[model samples]
Target chain A: MKTSYHKLKNFINTPFGVILLVAAVVFGVEVLVMEFLFVFVPVIQASVPPIAFNFLDAVILTLAVSPALYFLIYQRIHADAEKLRKITESAQDAIIVMDNHGRVSFWNEAAETIFGYTKTEAIGKELHKLIAPEKSLNAFNHNFKGFQETGEGPILESVREVMALRKGGEEFPAELAVSALPINGTWHSVGIVRDITARKKRENLLRERERELTEVNEYLRNKEAKEQALLASLGEGMISTEIGGEIITINRVAEEMLGWKEAELVGKKLIEAIPAISETGNIIPPENRVCLNVTAGACVGPLTDDTSAFVKKNGESVPVAITTTPVIIGGKCSGAVIIFRDITNEKELEKTRRDLLSLASHQLRTPLSGTKWLIETLQREIHGTLTEKQGEYLTQIYKINERMTNLVHDMLGVLRMEGDINPAKIEPVSIQTLFGVITETLGNVAKEKNITLEISKTAESSIDTDSLLLRNILECLISNAINYSNEGGAVLVETKRDGADIVFSVKDSGIGIPADEQRQIFQRFYRATNAKTFDTKGTGLGLYIAATLAKKIGAKLTFESAEDAGTTFFLRLPASAK
Target chain B: MNHVLIVEDEDFLVRALKDNLVSEGHSVAVAMDGEAVFDELKKKKPNLILLDLLLPKKNGFDVLKEIRQSPEWQLIPVVILSNLGEDSEIKKALELGANDYFVKSQHPIQEVIEKVREYLEGKGSTKVGL
Candidate 1:
């Protein structure tokens, strides 16, 4: 019906409908004039008296013409409506038309699909009642009434996302655009709607991704700031460079250490800016530079090559110990960091200390030795036979001198042990000859104590060691054994060959080291709590010196003891190949 | 009787040692320096040498080296007695063929007498000091 009506509407709208209406009106008026003339002629007044009384024919003609004119007008109006329907049907939006009475006058194919109401069922129903949400129905009714009265509505021609109901009674977001169209001197509304649920979901996902990206970017910024702060706050000189050895950053300590400002050193090659100079005043080559080695994925320790110094900007050299590490990421060296400490003052202090120690040993011992010899000469009764009282005083003097000598001697030994000693003079030493010397030195003391001192050598092979150092160690251990043991307690000194090592052990039947104080026995100046009550003269440096000396000579000292029983100390030296 | 040479610069120490050695029935000669030791050696070969390390003009180590330079004097045993009793110095003296070492103040005069007697007894033993 719509297709047929549109064809006729197009024909009338052009020229056919205009000409047909004009011709019908003109023909009706001409017929009326002819009939009036025929009825009003004088010569036929009497003959046509029945004709003048033919008003029924005129009334019948008027009724038939009026009904025909109304049919023509209705057909033309239907044709115009079909043309508007065609425009609305092809649009993507659901086009809904409602008349002045606020009832649904037209629901296009899109409107039927969007709202789930057929055109037949939707027509004559209020438009807002069909699709408006219950929450918005009151507002919609007020706006619709205003629209009908003034041809104005709040949403007219305004596109917005609105909650819309579908035919399945489900609600979804939609984009609605509304406008008023006038026809027959009354206003109708055309509402264009589009489903926007899919668009809204896409927009939401995009917003979430944007937020995540911003958070990640912010976190990275904060981490970078924290790293920068840490690098700037370090106490040791720190220099960082790109993988190519170009200087990228230098901390405040590095600037002060090198005597170059950060701005002056940045972008310069690390090796070029701060040269690694040897103490002998030679510039080191690049391949030998510690930072470059780190950049090449090498883990290099403190580079004190030739007592290395880092030459500063003003041509002064500062002795330093440099250590470099690579900043590795994914198995690649992205950069390198070098940390160095200035040791000039420390080195100077160390040298001064060594000098003072050497002086003390040489100068102080000379006079002390002279005093001891002079006192010993008197005690030998070379001056005369002394009275008992004089003899006792002389003996006291002798003991005091002896104690002083031992203290000075042990103090000097500690100095030497702590400092560098020349490597032990390794030589062939016979255990038989060695023990002979030890026994000869310690036997009288052992005899006085009534402690049987025993010696046994089980190894047939000759042992190699620094004989003097070995003698000192054995002397300390044997003397300690004698000193700590009760009268009549025996001391056993033995030597044997363990696999790859020669084990020399000193076992004593004496007061054992207190369990709690055992670990601290090797520390300098540490005395066992038990020793304080024994009235024995102990330097408290015996075991410390013994242990350190043993270590220097590549030996291990291990001991075992039980309280009130006895203690055994073992010195294990590497069995040397002849 | 053993003839002993006391090569030392200290007169009191020399006099005391000489008195002790004389009482012990050994003839003792005095050399105050390394040069004096050479002069004394030329005058009469001693049976034993008691060498002091820190002597005037020339030390005992040089005197000992000079004495060891000749086979005639090298056979004579020398005992080094000194206040410099550090292991390095002691090892050095022993390495240069001194018979034995004793610290001057560490031991009493009796111990010194004992060490001198041992060397005096082995005057011509000819065993190398090392």
Candidate 2:
């Protein structure tokens, strides 16, 4: 029951309930007066006519209810007006009211704070002229004319963003919403304005970041395209794999070489996608694969394995020279890149060259040998006797034949060295015995030059090496020493041990190599200018063959030379030859 | 004097070798081609055979193989005198039962004669002029 009474009291506080209550009170008063007159004032009611008595009752009802109704309705309206004023005063937005004359009628505290003006200074002032930017006044005035006449305009009753001027003459962005109000038959506008500077700054920052992101995205896309073009332009077949040996990318050449499409090979393990076979026709396992070793970081540098063949998709094998390099990023192995080329044509060409070299060697040496034998027969006087002059002529002919033979031998040696024929046959070669044989072979040549060949054998230990190659190298060095030495000059063939390695030094007191030409001393057909002047018969291939043979035997050949002083050629053989 | 057989195709080289052998007091017999070697061996068992690799009818390797296959010629010392100086060719010739190998240009005729004389004297096999 108490809750119902409270609900009724709350409803009576509304404007519609107040009106209904007033009407009920007024009716009650009218009824009570009419009943009182009919009951207690019967003489007056009987003396007057019925219609006139009704009129008198109506007058009394109006007189008693008019003051009470007026007082209650007026007090309620006054309190509501005061509540509205308080709400507008405390609002965060600037609440502004303008009269129809375009003057500011009321301004809230927010307006004072926003426009840098007190309410007293803002009121009664032309609102547009006071707060609108100077450049915006013309448009404001134009819109205000229509707003004043119809109390309606495009800017009225709708929110808009506008440039607002502060009292200090600074400008800022603002949101303005205006609604029309009419009081005393004149139009007025109440506007709510909010400052939007901070919001505008945040929006601009977001736009700038978006533009930067777009530019970076465009740059990356172009860079990726350029890299694709470069990869496609390579002549050799290329494959890239992740660190785990999974194929990441394969180029067009690689696709054609393997007979596998890029899509089919990508994301597959390298060893599975393309199987490598050894020369013995055995499949190379994953542990021995070059690309996998590189990707797994087990290989330190670029490795080239040319003795293996890769089986194509069609099950045909192609011999290839594959070079695998690890991709290192930030000191870590990230992936691997394998570059390969089909060496079938190269292998065939090499075989053809070897055949040609062999044929040439046989053909050229046959005639040379025939000449040598005929000259030797004449010199030996096997068929008949010869005069001293005829013997001298035959000896000259024999010497020329011998030179031609040596030239052919040197040429063939150079070709064989380049062709990489005949793997080394390793054996224990005594240093003393090797030097003895080389010095004996070159003894006649030293005798021709009247040069003394001295042997200083300090190293008696035998080294494991290819005996033939070691003998050839030592013979060339000794002969070169004798050939370049002046008459009576000494040629010392010395040998000693230097920390597990045997060093053979051929020191010659001869016309040493020129300083500038020493760098190219080992080059094929390259003779020092001074040596060429001294000996016209030198083939210049001796040292080149020696150097190549040294490399083949895993030895190091170096020399020290000074002009006219002497040259010492050093051959350092490792204890364990590769 | 022991009889020696010269199996060679080159006329000039054959003449010089025959004349030198005759001068050395050894009976000289000639087989111009590989096919005539058996014919010459049938007529007389030469003490030594100087074989030249490049021949008209059959190469020296086939001749050497056939010679080793025959019981009568198997005991004869056959020396290879070829201008093919490659190690592989030399090794092939030696592997085919050549008693000795010599690159002709690298060795003098006197050295070859000395080798033939040594073989005729019944000395054991020796590899030379490698």
Candidate 3:
């Protein structure tokens, strides 16, 4: 009740309430005046009767209040309409009022700006025909027919997005909202239209970015799958680890070889998960592990070894030829990749080869030895004296036998060196003693060739190396030098200290190697063209055997030669062999 | 005269060795295989035994082991003359108490006689020739 009283009090203070109150007071005063005249003025009241007097008073009251009511209510309503017009004109959206006939009845300032028309030009124009695209006009006309008849249509009182034509005849996306209004019993539509071209551009750009992101994602997934397939298809057991030797991936071969699942080994330190053992059956420590060493950046080269074995999950050791390479990225060691193969079959094959070679050597040497003793017996003339012609024939046979013996020895030496079965036995070797032994071994050959063999020592140094291997290499070099020398040509076997290495060079003033054939001189069974022609009985395996032995003892065998001039072969050995 | 026993499978090598030893003024006994070695040893204790590794009946390693184990034959010098020239085989022969190890193809009959003379004269205990 209190709130209603307050509201009534507030309403009475309004202009319309004041006008109503004044009209009501004026009617009451007119009624009181009519009553006084009827009661006091007897002559007038008798001539005009009571009803006529009341009607006269009502006429005078109406005439007095008419102008006041019009002044107050009409002026207030006009002011309100003007305020609404100002608001509509100042809006950013185009505001238009369309009459029931579909013609623009009211055009605001925004509408003129949006439609490229002055208010006078737009006011009487058909709104849809003027602004709607040609494609949309049919639909607009169909909907407008219903609106014209009932002031209601499917598009009325709803927001919709439509293509609109700008002043320049360019179509742009726009948001439109229409509301119906009744003025003087005629339906008019108030429309709010907003240009949405910028919004639509933003949406299109967003969609384009989304599609690109999806494509990039697909490409990455494909690359990852390809890498996975490559890893899976590898024949060797492969393991990839992080910088700390933690296993990141293990391929199917590695899993099967190690008897461990990928999930079981991943994230575990490789050294701990699969222990490596040396040939002597001692566990290789973590710091000595090739993968860890590579990951720690301590090792730059790929470390490979065939004697190492990895202990499987079942405690069985499998011999493997393993190579561990660092995965370097941007000059930094990121991780390590270990590729290995089960070399058990290879080892067995090598053993078989070695056995076969050994057996062949023994079998061939037995018959050769028998022949050698028989020839020696004949040369010694134990049974009977030999004639001069017979002696010459025996000498020829001896030479051929000697050549056969040398060939057999060279072949055996090559087999031993190639197999790497005979490890170097390091000992202190006197350079002078080595030279003396080599010269003596080749002295007979040099004498037969009429070549002068000389041994000169610049610096007498004892080198720690395998005596047998060094002897074999020097003997080969000295013999080659002597055999290739021209008659009476001098061959020099010299040794000196070159830095921390022992340099043994055999210089011969004989047919030098051709420049093109020098590279292939160290290959097995390769004889220089001139050397072959000069000595048809040359085995062609001397330098190859020498090089193989040199390599076994950590020596570098190099040479410099000029065709028809001379060739000098240098064997450089570290003072303390590794 | 020092009696030298030639234990070899090859007829030519044995003949040459016997000739060389006999020419050097030593009586020669022949054992063509590992079994003949013991038969000859049982009949007469040779001053020195020339052993061949790859024998017909038994290998030289087992023959040498048995010779060294026997008190009567242990005193006799055993020399290995074999075509098997690998270091391991040589080492095995020497480790079995052979007085000397020589790869037969790598040594001439004269060198074998020289070695035999050195042993018979009590001038050499152990020697390896390849």
* Candidate whose DockQ is highest: 2
lDDT at position A148, candidate 2: 73
| Best of the candidates, TM-score | 2
For each prediction, how big is the interface RMSD?
A: 3.2, 1.7, 2.2
TM-scores across all candidates?
Answer: 0.66, 0.77, 0.74
Error of 2 at A43 (Å): 19
Residue by residue across A1-578, what tens digits does model 1's lDDT show? 85456556655554456456545574576567657766666446755543343455555665667556656766887798788778789876788878888888878888887788999988899887778777878788778777776678888878988988876678888999889876444668877888787888898889898999899989999999998888888878888888777788888888888889989988888888888877677898877775677755564433333268898988989988777777877876687888888888876876786777655765666666566666666666777877889879877876677777778878887887777534677888877877878887889889888988988757545677888788889999999999899998999988887888999999998999999989999999888988867734677888999998898788999999988899999999988845
Worst 10-residue lDDT window, candidate 2 chain A: A48-57
DockQ of each: 0.26, 0.56, 0.43
- Candidate 1 chain A: minimum summed lDDT over ten consecutive residues — where? A297-306
**lDDT tens string, model 2, A456-557?**
748356889998898999889998988898999999988887887888899998999899988899998898999878977788899999999999898899
Expressed as tens digits, the lDDT of each residue in A1-578 for candidate 3 is: 85466457656656667666667777777878777877777666667654446576596776688567758766888899899999998998889889888899988888777778788888888988888899999888888877765578788778999998877788888899998866544567999988788989999999999999999999999999999899999999999888888899999999999899999999998899999998889999988876667756554759877788999999999999889898888988888999999998888888898798779888988988888787777777776899999989987886677678778888887777787754688999877777766664567668778888888756666899998789888888887888888899999878888788888899999899999898999998999899888877688899998898888899999999999899999999888865
What C-alpha lDDT, on a 0 to 100 scale, does residue B70 get in candidate 1? 85
Candidate 3 lDDT by residue in tens digits, B1-130: 9988888999999888877777678998999988889999988889999999889989889999999999889989988888887777877888888888877776667677788889999997664422
Q: After superposition, how far is residue A537 of candidate 3 from its true place, in Å?
A: 3.2
